[model samples]
Target: MKRIVAAAAAALVLAAVAACFVYWDTVRSWLPQEVAAVLGAETEDGGGERDRSAVAVRLAPVELATALDRFETSAEVTAAEAVEITSEVAGRVETVLVEDGQRLEKGAPVIRFDDASEQAAVNAARAALAEAEAALGRSQFLFEKGVATEARLETDRAARSTARAELEAAQARLEDRRVRAPFAGEVGFVAVDEGAYLSPGQEIVRLKTTDDLRLRFDLPLEVAEQAAGIGALRLVSGPEGCRQARLLTVSPLGDPTSRTRRFEAALPDGCDLTPGAFITVAAVTGRCPEAVFVPHKAVERRGFESFVFRAEETDAGLKARRTLVKTGVLTGRRIEIREGLDEGDRVVAEGLQKIEDGAAIRPAGEEARR
Candidate 1:
């Protein structure tokens, strides 16, 4: 009786296992790759069995060549000398000497404030100085003629010195009411009109050098250290082919908030870039002579790991072998494959995400890779 019951239980267990096998494809298709693979699925992309049909993809061969290794970043076009004009003393505006967009040289007057009282004080001080000088001359002559005492001459001399000092003080006050350009530059909009009162340090107008232009940018600490070896920056966007800008300076101090260092480069002469306009810049960090590189699209990033699908020919056709790579410097359109690939190796540059490990592929490399 016991043997007969055990045989019936074995038959029921075999039937249940057969039923699960029939639905294995559909059930595991909805599960994660790890769970699905353990449960009879056979793929690496976290899915069910991968399709055997080939996916059309463009292939880029790895090359051992010399290429620029650059770090690309956006930079702002700026005038080498730029400042906003401001008043140094409080007064009512008398005249606006410069109009909007007018270019002025250093020491050129931009605006003048009301200086009637200052002018009067200057005139009075000048008259007192002249009077004191005349008295000293008279006293010197009289002393030579024995008609004036030494004490009298000395008193005249002291009075002349005092008067001279007073004149200088008055003139300096008068000049403070006039605003002059500190450097040669074109004026922006005139901020004040006639009869408008302005306080000390109030803005009058903006001045920016027209021809003297620079490119200003920021880079992180690591990239900045690499940029130290480069002599120039490439202007990525321009009518002419990538123009070179002369490297000027990098700030000694770094910004604590952004953790970046400021960099400035002198733009090439006759380059008609507007001030305050932004332009893209790329700086070469280093160059590789015999390094392996592939198209930028050939690499795929999964989480923190970067991968490339290398195309290998097999008896059936071409198959994709997903490879883990270590990357180096990146230029414009290509990235350095420091590891995981060799020269002349083929990689699926386009349609990287549609396939996984051991997936079939069709190479469609019609256009030449530059």
Candidate 2:
């Protein structure tokens, strides 16, 4: 019975040894080719040294490129000139000359008021002036013939002058009855109908000169100084794309409440943009001629510190050295490396998670593990 128990224990020990061998062989087969080669070399040399397989990574060389230092903000569209058309004198509207949404040129008639009384006054004044002129001519003839006094001739001349002034006043009144456009623009809703009596200073319609639209935006006080010398600005809308605009004016003062400065820009002509639409404004503050940039994926951030793995060639082979970097503006997929990097330095762009400081690296497109 003791021999049977011993035999069972021996069988159990043999089965455990075979299971351990199978598990180790499966793990070795699953290892990366480069790691397996290193381990095989160490095992064949009868060494118990730790594996020194390099981490495979892709590299990108730093290059100088143009970096646009710009500030983006929201802007509102406005007309270059907008005003509410009002009546200068009280009169009854005779004709509604312009319809809503009608485009008109400068001096085009927009509204016509009843001018019968004004025209009658003008005609009466003209008739009185004609009679005064005839009388003045007769007085001058009598004076030349020595039959009229100088005082008499002066009285006739004064009467003629008064009549002429009356006629001029009447004509001005007649002209005021007809409302004309102040400038070239598209008219908004007409507020009065024909035969409607309007009082002086009453709003008649709205006029907006929108051939060239203006964009107004506010920038924070800190960034206001950067936009001082910018010659042009860019406006971006969803799907409409980007349009160039000229900087028209900037407010000399900042708003105390919002701590922002107001800026205005003129949009290009022939664009189908309407006033009151919101758009994105981008103002280029400055440019860096020799800015060093790299793929954004190359940067690794741990807390507030940014790091990049640099591929350095040495006597042993290519190795990845972790480098600390200061980053600037990020434009699209590229990032500006302001410090701790130089032009032409190689950095690991991909496979960064598998690497550590001072680890061996086999760069992309290079053969390893013969």
Candidate 3:
């Protein structure tokens, strides 16, 4: 019985030894050669400073650059003054004086109506007024000589007043037959020909004062407030090129659907921008004179706090020191470092995930040099 128990114990010990050797071989095959060597070295050396120098990263020097935050939006060009010409009185057109695309001064003759009947009425009213005046004069003379009563003299005076009012009305009717330009502008097109009958409020032509233009644009509510302080805005059009415009006014209310505000700017004179032209508006909202900037990859965010790995040179080697940074505007792939960084400071731009605070580093390329 003792001999049988000894043989079983020996078998169990040999089986456990075989299992341990198989596990060791599998683990060794899975590990990379260099990683295995490094692991073996660290284990042999009791995990010393050599493990800290294994991280490789790329570095970039902080640079002084101009940073601008701007708002770009599309706009439309409109004339400073534009109106549709229309007739105020119904009449038969006798003559059309102005042609299409004709520039005219204020009070220039545009159209004339047939005024023969109106002229005859004015003449008849003038004759009646003269007769009433003569009768009034005679009645006054008779009243002073005791030949006419006071009631007769009053009647004569009333007749003269009525005749005068009638004559004035007749003259006004004659004047309305001549249609003239209300303001100085270029005419668009004549809608009526010679002898064409027109009613009141009928469109004649469109007049536009194009010497100066109004640039209309919409901006986001947040950006609109910043744009208000800008001295001038740039208007860009394909055919008219770029021109400077001064802000005139902004809408008091914002659009609820788009959450944008409307703004109008007055363009300078002599620009070839016509009404309804499409344009691009550019306004600089903020600018930094000497902003310190670094590549965006260098910045890492942990919750609300932003930090970067600064490449600090030490007697041992290049070390990555975690630095808390205050950042401003982010333009493209670069970010503005407002605090905790200075120009010419080296920062780790790549391979930051494998590094920690005060970890030794090997720079990847020549970008580390100032």
Candidate 4:
């Protein structure tokens, strides 16, 4: 009786297994594709000859897109005027006229050296010049009156000329004692203090014009030709908002190492940017009014030729047609198909290596829809 019960249980288990096998297709249809595939599902379309051998692939469409002909590159901000401040004459600093980050006008005093000595020297030279001038006048009068020799008049004239030269020299030296700004700008720093000795050519500060800035950058060789037509640009760095820049100039010589051309654009008025600040520049080179774009993965290059597996609908199912295509600008994820492609054409976006020319294919999403 126990053996009879065991045999009946075994028969019931076998019947259940057979029922599951018979309904496996119906069960797989309810499950997800990944789960169904794991359970030995057929990789095919609905009851078609091509579907029996169809390869699973993801599809992307080749459609007309507005291709904005533009490029982005690194750039730097430049000042209208920038100079390193240094004293022309060595002296003891009487006072530092400017501090770090000070705004000043042209000819504004940056540092005042010990000008007392310079002033005294200038005064003495002026007195000597006045005396020499008086003596020269007297000597000229005497010579005219036959009371002085011609050689005496000549000597007086020479003395007067030498005195004038000495006075001018003293005045120049006095001017050197007070270091002034060459242009209206903001100063970086004043390194010296009152009563501190400063050597000639020692950097006192750096003066840079903060407004009317410019952008300088190198443009690629391919787009450098359009530098002329690209008159305006947009800067992508600095501040919260973006502003436009006008084309200033392009260097005649190209960079040998980068194989690019240098470009400069003038920033607008009231710009907050300063010299040496880095920026990103965007410029429009050209535009393609009508262009067929495809996913970059769909296109592959073998040696000299480039090709894409485009999906072609047939009575049996979809087939991958290995179509040769001419490629254009490849920016980001989309690639421009210059030739051999049109709008509404579907191309394989994923699993490109698994499929070959004329290979049967089924859209991976088709299973989910069914």
Candidate 5:
């Protein structure tokens, strides 16, 4: 009975050993190859003949040009000349010569005041002058005939001069009743209509000369320094493409609170832009001749560490090496490569997800492993 139990135990142990050998032998060979396969793909830089087939990478010719750092700023539109019209005389408004929003010529009559009193005064003065002149003629004749004294003739002459002066003064007062435009402009809403009583120095209307419209904006101090020498900057209306302007002035002093420089630009005549319409201003600040740029996607930053991929040819063919790089300004989709790269160095642009360091790869030209 004991020998039968020992035989059963021996058979169980042998069978377990055989099964373990079968599994290990079959899987071990494929394990190394499968694990390294992923590494191989990631390490393959897409430049070599094998790399070209592994991933489709298109190359672009590098060009030399200036790159701008675009900044969006808030701006305001202002009229070049605006004025509030006021009446200078005290009287009843006889007639409002111009309507609201009417374009007026320089020196055009804008408002008329009642001048009947002044006209009546002028008539009275004229009659008085005629009576005085007759008396003066009689006095002169008497003085010449040796009947009147010289003093009496002088008194009659003075009275005639006073009457003439009074008539001239009344006519001048009548002219003051008509208010004319100080300059050519478009009139705003008239505050007082015809027949409204106007006191001295009452506001009448607002007038604006809109021949040259302006767009004023403030820029940062650093940006202003670079653009200070630019005499004229070109302005394109956003999306509308309907208007443009030239630089007018740059303020020497900056705002205390905002710490920004102020600038003004003028639009040409017949421009469709209206005052108070917001627009963008582009100021170019020259170029950097020694700048080297790369795709923004190729750079990866973790903590304080920044890295890029560099492709090189090896005995096993092309491979990607992770390289640490220092970078500069990022203009659009490209970034300036300050270090860790040189001209003509091939880089990986896409398909970096599966790549691993020191992995064996079946690139475009290399044969697939069995």
Candidate 6:
């Protein structure tokens, strides 16, 4: 029994030693080669840093759209002219001649108020005028024949004048019952229908001239300065439809919160553009005689600072230098470089993550042209 136990113990010790060898080999492969060498494992490069390649900078013709000074504003489309059609007298709206969205001509009848009261008043005034004239004639005949006193004749003349004035007032009141279009425009918000009661001064319809439209937009202070030099503003539709408009008005005061200025352009003749449609406005502010522009994606931001990498071919090899650039206006994918880089400098547009200062680089896509 003692001899058998001694043999089993020896076998168990050998198995444990074999298991430890396998574990150490697996663990060594999982570690970084440099770390493994430091920990007494065999690795290449004598555990030194490994050299790698980074993205090279490219120089090419980048078509840049010179960003003009424009006030980036929020404005609504408005009619160049608008008038409110209201009921002049209090009465039931007997008939509405036009509906909402109807194009109307100047002096067109828009609404008609109940004219019964006005007509009655007119008739009453006529009767009173006739009575007064009859009295005046009778007094004149009696006075000429010396049968009436001059004081009585004067009284009769005054009554005749009073009656005539009332007649004119009644006639004017009758005209007020018929509402006429003050100007040519499209009818809007026709709230009253036939037989709807409307008080005096109640809104009947809004007439807005669509022949000319006015668009208003706000511009930031940065671009608002250019407005003084610009004679007009240009607006373009989403599909590149262009329209030129005269500078109608601009706000004298700037917004305290946004420091933005308000500007308006008048479309003298309204085209396919309608009120309330959003369109882009371009106003040339100032020009930079010599400026360098680059692809916007090439610039990276860290906090408030922006930076880019310039490719340099050193004696050792190709590498990059971190450069800080001041950016101006950004249009589409390109940004205007206000400072930091010269016009001939090359910048990395892609694979920026793999680049570091003094890191070796090789061009990946297009070849850099001088």
Top candidate on TM-score is 4
Q: Count the backbone clashes (under 3 Å) in each candidate.
A: 0, 0, 0, 0, 9, 2
Quick one: ranking by lDDT, best first?
Answer: 2, 3, 1, 4, 6, 5
**Best by lDDT, which number?**
2
lDDT tens digits, residue span 1-370, model 5 = 9999999999999999999979765765465443344345445543345443333222222323455544455566667887778877899999988887798989999888998998898899889999999999999999999999999999999999999998888888887888888888888668888899998889988877767677789898877887767755556454355345677799999888998999887766776655657877675666667666777777788899877666666786656677788876678788877678876765555435445444333322122342
Candidate number with the higher lDDT (2 or 4): 2
**Deviation from native of the Cα of residue 334 in model 1, angstroms:** 5.9
What would the per-residue lDDT of candidate 6 be over residues 242-355, giving only the tens digit for each residue? 466678788888999999888887765536666667777676667765667889888899999998877776876567788898988777778887777775677777767866
Model 6's alpha-carbon lDDT is: 0.75
Which residue window of length 10 is worst by lDDT in model 1?
A: 33-42
TM-score, model 4 to reference: 0.72
Scored by lDDT, model 2 comes in at: 0.86
Angstrom error of the Cα, residue 273, model 5: value is 4.6
The number of residue pairs in model 4 that clash at the backbone is 0
Which candidate model has the greater lDDT, 3 or 6? Answer: 3
Distance from true location, Cα of 214 in model 6, Å: 2.5
TM-scores of all candidate predictions against the true structure: 0.68, 0.60, 0.58, 0.72, 0.56, 0.71
Once fitted onto the true fold, the runs of candidate 5 whose alpha carbons sit more than 4 angstroms away are: 1-65, 69-79, 126-150, 212-215, 238-246, 269-279, 291-370
Worst 10 residues of 4 by lDDT: 37-46
For model 3, residues 144-183, the per-residue Cα lDDT tens digits are 9999999999999999999999999999999899888888
Q: Where is model 1 more than 4 Å wrong at Cα?
A: 1-64, 220-222, 236-242, 252-259, 268-274, 295-297, 302-305, 311-321, 326-336, 343-354, 357-370
| lDDT (tens digit, per residue) of candidate 2 on 7-102 | 999999999999998987788789865565556556776753323466656788897888877898888888889999999999899999999889
lDDT of 6 at 99: 86
